[model samples]
Target: MATLPNPLPSLATSGLDLPPGTLVDTTLDGTWHEPLLWYADGPPADLRAWSRLRAAGRPLGLLPVLVTGGRRDQWPEEWDLCPDAASYPGDHDADEVLAGYWTEYAADEVAPEDTGPGTDGTGPDADGSEGPGPWPGLAPVPAREAAEDADTAAAGLAGVITADADEWLGGARTALVPARRSADIPAAIGWSGPMNHENDVARLCAVLRSWEDRYDARVVVLGFDTMIVSVGRPPGTIEEARALAAEHYAFCPDNIDQSPPYDLDAYAEKAVLNQEAWSFWWD
Candidate 1:
């Protein structure tokens, strides 16, 4: 069994951290300036901090809340699961949401039969072989590094970031990393399949637009779905964060019903094309 790393202390105290080894999760196009949103709503620890801050009128910088009861172990493949749920914010079930996200990507990568019992292989391999060999693993893009790359790619129009969330009184200790491994996304293709729906794409763009409007940041680094915006200032309350995210979600014009499930290959492309999605760091 793979031994999971302990939750990073920085993220534990605030809400985000830049612990080393954290992977980037977005595409090049997503490098636009905006904060990555991780939704959680469950236990007291998870709910209390978020609720207290929101109730007190803190912006929490787009930390959306979603309720679930599963453990992080349930979503081992998900990079957003917060390694150890014991230190997760408020009542949000980080595991379930991450699992759902990963499941969507997994669904897009392989056929039903290939994802059978005891099969760790995601979807069908490029060669359509189920036997374990070198199955593609979903990788997250880092925030700070990604920002640098995006800046380099955009010829100075964009810049990268790696700030300590705790540095800001109300900032979450979230760490941002680069979304793409290389500046060249198209040339760095890895997975195969559709990862997001039109609605999802639209929703992401809406969020990016909102963030861009609020902050001057723009570019997609990590994945297509993620958008990193340059914020002149970070929100201090959870309510403010929710308000921003809700507005972004509402901004999307696509229909969820018409959207297909997440595919690993598609998710990979999203991470590759959108630079913002991959850049994950504290606000």
Candidate 2:
């Protein structure tokens, strides 16, 4: 992946109020030349520290994320990161990537038993398979009539996750990653958590960068194979939610496919519409 000069190497003298931490440079192939990220030795005590770390990291072009050691006991050290396989986020366009995925998967999800004719309608194809006619396309950014700041909302959600450590994340650690933005965190560290869905993570990061502009979204928490994105401006109407649902479906199919009662409308209502956070798990 094309990247900026890594600042993690000089973190020790950067004058940031950091806790005892471990700089990780390990990858699936072997040890990376520079540290991929720096995670705290323990879980964050409260939201204040999370906010502080986020603020401290931003000046140095480092983005803060809550890294959880899940039930599987896989931390960043154990994660099989593949930086070599990733690409730069700026190299790909968000719409094209999402459109490609929607075309490949939407037919299976939206098309049902012999339904109708038009694009949105269901119908069988030349291969004798059912599908929705065409990709629904991307959703427009919801107007921020009274939206909260993205970082504030992210910190609030992080607070909730940390407060209920026993219930949610096994142990949440604050990790400072050298990234251009929050959306690029996955590609920066070459996180392969969603490999089944998208092999080159930078492509997914492209869509995330679009989300950051449209929804005031931030990548807040990441476990071994899970993610939680805090959305500051969510869809206010079902129309908007449904449109956004197509994008979500393309991004993570398990969110709708493996989920029982597998319905797009239901997924939009329960997971996307006006919700401050959207969580995903790859199986």
Candidate 3:
């Protein structure tokens, strides 16, 4: 994968006011060619610290991302990161990726007889509670004006999550990564969080890029195998949310099927409709 010139090595002399932190180069394949990121030793006491880091890092081509050590006790060092294995986020198309996954996995969850044209699987016995069928297309963007700027909403949501880091993140820390965009943060670190589902995280990032453009979403927090994004514009009606839910199911089936309610409509109403924060976990 192509990359920007790493500035992490010069962070000490970069004249940015930064808290004491360690530069991480540890990967599964031993040391990486350059430091992937720099992270503070502990959680920030307040959200101001995060805002400061983000402001300071941007000029130097660095971006801030919240990193969690997960309940299983995994951190960046133990993440087995493989930046070398990731493709650029811009290389793939989001709709194609989601559609592919939708087509491939959406059928598996339902019986072969239950899946076909005109059957959406929303019926009570269908896998998704909606009738099971071929991939549904992307969700429509909300026509209503966004409640807030994407970046501003992301910062606000980050503060909320950071304030209660233990409750939301297990034990999360702030890290600055070198990336072109927030959606690329995971691929920049070569995160294998969704390895059980999709080995290449950039494909998922592609879908995120679409959300960034359509819903004004930001990649706010990342856990060992979970991701939470802040959406400035969320679906305002069940019709809109139900459409969005199909995309979510294709993106992370576990978020709907494995979790309670076990129905797409319920997941849409509770997780997508008018909700600012969208969290996805890959099992």
Give the per-residue lDDT digits (tens) of candidate 3, residues 1-283.
5678888999999998777788989987899989998888888868877778888898888988888887876878888888887898899998899889877777566334333343223333334544465566778888889977888898899899888988987887888999878899888889888888898888988999999998999898887788999999998988788778878888998987689877677787899999999999998
Question: What shift in Å separates residue 70 of candidate 3 from its native position after superposition?
Answer: 2.2
Ranking by lDDT: 2, 3, 1
Looking at model 1, residue 86 earns an lDDT score of: 19
lDDT of each: 0.27, 0.84, 0.82
Please give the range of 10 consecutive residues that has the lowest summed lDDT in model 1: 184-193
Candidate 2 lDDT trough over 10 residues, lowest sum: 113-122
Which has the higher lDDT value, candidate number 2 or candidate number 3? 2
Q: In every candidate, how many clashes are there?
A: 111, 0, 8
Candidates' TM-scores? 0.22, 0.92, 0.92
lDDT of 2 by residue, 37-75 (tens): 999998787768779988888888898999988987789
Model 3, stretches more than 4 Å misplaced? Answer: 110-131
Candidate 1 per-residue lDDT, tens place, 117-186, comes to 2222333345765522232222111222233432232322122222221222112222222122111111
> In candidate 3, what residue range of length 10 has the lowest lDDT sum?
114-123
Clashing pairs in 3: 120-131, 120-132, 121-130, 121-131, 121-132, 122-129, 122-130, 122-131
